[model samples]
Target chain A: MFEEADPDLLPEGLSDRLPPLAAEALRVTRAMNDVLAGHGFDPVQPPMVEFERSLASRMAGTKRNRMVRFVDPASLRTLALRSDMTVQVGRIAATSLKDAARPLRLSYAGQVLFLKGNGLEPERERLQVGAEIIGNDTVAAASESVSLAIEALKAAGARDISVDFTLPDLVDTLAASSLPLPEAAVPAVRRELDAKDAGSLVAAGGEAYLPLLYATGPFATAIEKLAALDAGDAVASRIEGLKEIAAHIDGAARLTLDPTERHGFEYQSWFGFTIYASGVRGALGRGGTYRITSEGGHDEVATGFSLYPDPLIARGAGSAKIERLFLPLGHDRDAALRLRTIGWQTVAALDASDDARALGCTHVLDGKEPRAL
Target chain B: MFEEADPDLLPEGLSDRLPPLAAEALRVTRAMNDVLAGHGFDPVQPPMVEFERSLASRMAGTKRNRMVRFVDPASLRTLALRSDMTVQVGRIAATSLKDAARPLRLSYAGQVLFLKGNGLEPERERLQVGAEIIGNDTVAAASESVSLAIEALKAAGARDISVDFTLPDLVDTLAASSLPLPEAAVPAVRRELDAKDAGSLVAAGGEAYLPLLYATGPFATAIEKLAALDAGDAVASRIEGLKEIAAHIDGAARLTLDPTERHGFEYQSWFGFTIYASGVRGALGRGGTYRITSEGGHDEVATGFSLYPDPLIARGAGSAKIERLFLPLGHDRDAALRLRTIGWQTVAALDASDDARALGCTHVLDGKEPRAL
Candidate 1:
């Protein structure tokens, strides 16, 4: 009977970050944010909830169904807990920071809530740390984003990093001109490409898109294969842009090409890349070129990346243990402050019977210095 | 036509933190969390949402109405966004960290969402930074909490800090013996005391509780007035506990006594405190002794404080300006990294037309050295 009434039960797909894991999460987030700041990305914080229309309209492909929603008591408008913070940064660029500068660099780190878990990933809440370069989607902006992403992941203690590039609008780019197809067949062709099913691509009237499937793995070879395909000049500039970005981050991180990989690149445009590390379970993060559509229907180009560092943190990356000093009852307070100033964690005794080792302290305060227990 | 579909509008009581203000919020949160960690408080992160029953039933006085709730599709159970993180800490102490040392110290910093804003405050979402001293609620525990809270607030750039102390169960302690009342009249007495209406307090059959109304002033004077009240020896030990806690933080902050003050001290017991700082619009934080009721119906004492530092962040405290160096096209990348290593924020130009001053850079990179703009 009491089991059913347990007050400690957390909801499914959620759990508390206890001890070292919690510290690791904070450290990894700070490290990544610091990397962004070092590159002149000023940090910005967007509230966790916003009007559903506001959240969905700032960026195309931001699905309203993914966000948890409720009616706002004040406005009677539907409010949504943010499923992605990228749109929020876009909103800020279009409104509050609209006049700040061109090619604005802003960073944000926050918890985003989703209405449901996707596929095998049962995490409804995740910590997203990212940087956005607004007002420009040039080849230079794309290159900067790719380089900064690789650097940020390395700063967070991720090892053997790899980046897999994609062109989110590749199908649209091809279908518009060189590889003409009926507008109705576009979605099916994109789906078949994502499924990597060549037979299904033909069934979807995308027989000419088969060459795109084999253009995967090693960036250098894959780019050559994609360039050799007879899609005319429709994707010529895009292929050259991808080559430039790959050259920029060549020595820093392992690079690959999959022009049709569209798993999490819902709002990405011409360029996109997914990051991975040797020991991590899934893709560490993704970034690419995109556009922020303003309230007046004007679209401003931009490039950025958002990193879901939970997997990296869960692997115990970047958490450093500190020395702790136990202060007995009646210990000198000034002496304890001195120790703390030099980086010692101090826990004072509440009473005479309190034990030092039991409180997780490795040393006892001996006058002003910490003496090993 | 665009006005109806504007996506830039945030819900009432919600706003974005842009530019310097956003950076300041991060700095303030880090300073307070650092103070917590220096005192040996291990960091923990509880998810933003939990089961409605789990959250509402963790600690006494946690109202379910304050939480924003919705159905969890996976569990088919009601899920509520956390309105307070203190009860979540209590649940962790009783469950996940049950076998840890006595007097466990845990710190947490996160965003909490409420269903509605309180009168005058008008903030439905807030950042709460706090530390808990679980497994103990002794006078020493209360003293540590008071001292830590003041220190944390000061570290976050608060000045002229003041703490108002109260006994949340004062009426219960009095009505049980000295000023006995019908069980039904107890809540009315509490309401009248909170309102500070002397006439209504008497009308509520709390005539003998009138002395507590006079016990509201500076700590030294008001504590004495409370001591002079002709109650049985019921409040004698509690008054002593308050005195000891005051003495511990005597020189650190201004102290006051209001034994019947019970506005937001819903779950507090023998001791409670509300912290205020000079220039801040309202209370910075509150803490006191409380008991955590486990699923087994066992009560374990705890003392803690949660600081809402948004007011201080809004005041632009703790944000430091850094000189940004703009790297023109074809500038040295290694030199820029070296400049960043020595604390210069570097923003590289995306193209030749990008202006340094427009991007908020105080200096531009001239070879390896920064030339003031």
Candidate 2:
């Protein structure tokens, strides 16, 4: 049994949204879905709680241990609140959507909980809006997902947005190289190489790996540099795919390639990218591909991104255009009914004049005197 | 530490929606917001987790013991995932939105978690879409919220819908009457009345309470009967308010009044209502008025409702229409890009003819033929 507290103290890290701001956030999330749906992405809402073993067992490394877990009294089974939507999406795609068509494009918007320290310093419940494309393994499908993400972000009012592209193959190439590097020396190699540390790269993987690490830069230049390197077949194949993606995007110059940049769950495969805006310190959204092995011997490729909307709003993105109309006090109920019937957004107030300004009314009607239309 | 699995098992209850259905749910939830927003309701989104203390303490009866509780790692405090949106809305109204203008009308669509048993027996996680109005306590505001809910449901494509209204004061009226009843006997009395068990009502509350209990019928007729009931001041005031609401709705023929309809959290005051549709035994949505008394002597009133959209969708209420365009193998990439730029939802396929029908595509363009558009 737990001791109850006095009512004054609210649970920490949770706060309520008031009228205008709350209204705006909801509007933005809806608009995001509208854009996504228009592009053929469908919505899927999963249950918030799931079997703890199913969620945490497969998750690699330290992240899984942070999930909030409890026992369901009725089932007497351990259940965990969903820590992320992608994993849930993966589960659904593998199970319920098994016999469905390949290249399934699903989108979702919901609140996902994570144990503190996964991302944000003081973990807060985040309102995440995201989309996932499963079973599509082609470069064209991947590029389209990226394009749609940019368009959706723009539709959600994100301005000056840019996408930073990173290839997982670049990291894989470095790891697979015949460098007699000790395990402890890997982090330093990754960091220094990411920072373009030539000396550190020479010290770790030797002068042979320098050109490949140094080739990382803006998309086009990096592609050309990687082509020029004496890289093996795997590295060369990755470069070709990256070039194809760069060629397909309308403004390929805006895309940056960072060979050493690695972010995302360890499960990510090829073609990872992040969306960045001015005020947002972290990526506004992030995603990559992961392979799911089905019941039989089939493997499905899935990729998607989730947007952290609170920071976007805090950065002055996604403010709703509120159109308010005020009806005068003592207005005829029948007339108000008529207005409602015609689909007008209205507020009927006793003190119409005061309420109009407070509600930010764009249009106000006088009840005292009926005017001609 | 946790045992590792093969990652084949999908977390229970969570789902991934395929095209058309996922698209349709998005459309329904969006349409709901459109209708609510048109009725002067602003949208709001609250955190998915709250302090277990804030949520449980305010819940007056059995509900306090049923919330899903877990320790939040960030705050190192016990937190409960929100079992319902109403309590979070109340906390916001009492604190954050306290200074906002009176009669704060807000709307929301999100996932809410309930402990295994409270009401929804087998299913615990639910997608709740609802609206809340805080501050001013008026029959008109309550009626507006109820009407908006009905309109929203209808817009979500619910063909058969019914709204059931009940007065909370009637329970107080029966309790205060000299109808000899023990504390535990009250729920049974209320249940019998709700089920219209006239014999049970008479046996429990006696002949004096029969008039009020049996006064359940069509909204208008029930209101008329309540007006004539020889009840105390509390019951009479509540009855008068119901009459006023019935008069305003005009289409009182569609409304049903069950004086014994006892549903809602303990904090609800005044009128309570639930929306029901075909194929769903439980109410598709439920909400009512709530008055909060804080430790600092602050008092606030809020009324709202939440819709369980998953069940509504399960009953085949809201689904989306989807059209897919498939581009054939060896198709001109430039042409596909042009089509996509012009707003066509296109998926480029290698060997398109083989997968076109399986992709649920209505139209397919062969890359070999330039004449085919």
lDDT of 1 at B204: 91
The segments of candidate 1 whose C-alpha lies over 4 angstroms from its true place after superposition are: A1-4, A182-185, A199-207, A317-319, B1-3, B178-185, B199-207, B230-232, B317-319
Give me the displacement of residue A151 in model 1, in angstroms.
Answer: 1.5
> How well does candidate 2 score on lDDT at residue B15?
44
Question: What docking tier does model 1 reach?
Answer: medium
The two-chain DockQ for each candidate, comma-separated, is 0.71, 0.49
B194-297: candidate 2 lDDT, tens digit per residue: 66777987777545667776577778788778767766677777777676666666662267887766756355677788888766677777767777655446
| Fnat of model 2, as a fraction | 0.58
Clashing pairs in 1: none
Encode model 2's per-residue lDDT on A1-373: one tens digit a residue. Answer: 2343345455555555655666667657877876676556667776677777656544352165667778767655677777777767766777778777777777888777765544354445677788887786566666766777777777666777777777754554656664435667666677666667788777765466577675665777877876787566776777777777667677732787776567563566777878876656777787666676543455677777777777666554335465566776656766666766666677766333346667656666556322322
Report the C-alpha lDDT of model 1 over A41-72, residue by residue, as the tens digit. Answer: 99999998998888887666678887889888
- Candidate 2's docking class is acceptable
